[model samples]
Target: MTWKDKLGLVHIYTGNGKGKTTAAFGLAVRMLGSGGKVAIVQFMKAPKAYGEQKKIEECGALIESFGLPKFVHGKPTEEDIEAAKRALARAKELASSGEWDLVIVDEVCVALGFNMLDVGEVRELIKSKAPHTELVLTGRYCPEELFELADYVTEMREIKHPYQRGVIARRGVEY
Candidate 1:
């Protein structure tokens, strides 16, 4: 069914702290509760690598994840670049298809942070989304340039964190 809202707005969740993806997933569930269609294209994360992957899929949201098994610290490898390109292409299709009420580009800012994807391409992806599609972009290092295109921009600043105390990312908590 087509969305009946007045408009679909762009949302950005970015900062150093956690919960960006969590917030996006929260909104996904909220939209699904009302029988809205959702699609999530994950960048820089491999398939079935995160806890939410299976659960979110079980909740009936379409999930597409792409990334190399290893993390990129400095210059990204050719595989990393290619994977992100594919993810962006799929995200572009979903965002502009008008078949989904919400389309999320998860960890996109991290891909941008690593230079795996171009900011200009991302800007165009946002602009090309269907007028009735609600878009949510999640991850850290979100460029200031994107804020102007969004209707809602929330930053999850890190005042304190378990990582500072030498804690590792716990499954189901950080992943």
Candidate 2:
């Protein structure tokens, strides 16, 4: 009944463009629709800020987000660092528990880029995941070394974005 043997693979969605989280959530939807379990640990994003959080949960996926209301820029504050660490710990536990078919660590690369998280910890989390768990990592500035460790590494290079025209993030599109 368990598809554990077939589910162990690492996916990385990174780069400056959009759709990294979208891709991850898309996979989450597929998994859940197919009677698979999923868990998402979001780093550097507040739980209530995103529209997907509520809807994804309604679709039977567990989501936990860690971050302050304010976005971290340049150097992160202690609160940001602590939140990232908490998210990291939860990600490790869920990824290794073998309870979910899909495990996503969202925005973790941003945490790494901002120095809120160390690549070593993320490296270890990937290494320690359950054998049957499918892992997804999302965000910009993903460490090149991690790409080498992934089974599917997708870089969403910005071809064009509405941000260039000064359009801000809109609900249901960019969230």
Candidate 3:
């Protein structure tokens, strides 16, 4: 029996800070190192040049992006909502496929917070996940209800950040 046969749990990473995606990616790396297949579904984040994305691909993991070209701040456009829905649907498909050992839903909370997706849909997706597939959800503004559904939840609190000092995100560091 493989390690995948012995484990499958829901993990949530959320808060008004950094490291949510980083933490999830770290876990993905660990899983990949253990001979497990990993799939990442990014919501609300468009396809772009990201260091981790390249590394994850090189590590033999799949990464799918469902987002617009720019970030949604004030109000999300119809295209944004459609993209988020597609992301959620793809996440559900991957989580239930039983082919992947781990499935990471990146920026899902942000999509939910932007009203592009529904909490119930996410809950259903979690509930319907394959028994042998571990799931990870990451993003800011996580709903309280999700805490009750998740097996483990980590909240990243931002005490300080370089963005606060007018420093823009650097390449390969904060992409």
- Following a full C-alpha superposition, what root-mean-square deviation does model 2 have from the true structure? 1.1
lDDT of 2 by residue, 65-174 (tens): 98788988888888889999999999999999998899999999999999888899999999999989999999999999998889999999999998999999898797
Clash pairs detected, candidate 1: none
Write down the worst ten-residue block by lDDT for model 3.
45-54
Model 1 clashing-pair count:
0
Q: Native-vs-model 3 lDDT? A: 0.92
Candidate 3, 80: how far from true, in Å? 0.4
Clashing pairs in 3: none
lDDT of 3 by residue, 11-117 (tens): 99999888999999999999999999999999987876578887898999999998888889899999899999899999999999899999999999999898888
Off by over 4 Å in 2: 1-4
Q: Which lDDT tens digits does candidate 1 get at residues 19-69?
A: 899999999899889888899999988889899989999999999998777
Each model's lDDT: 0.92, 0.92, 0.92
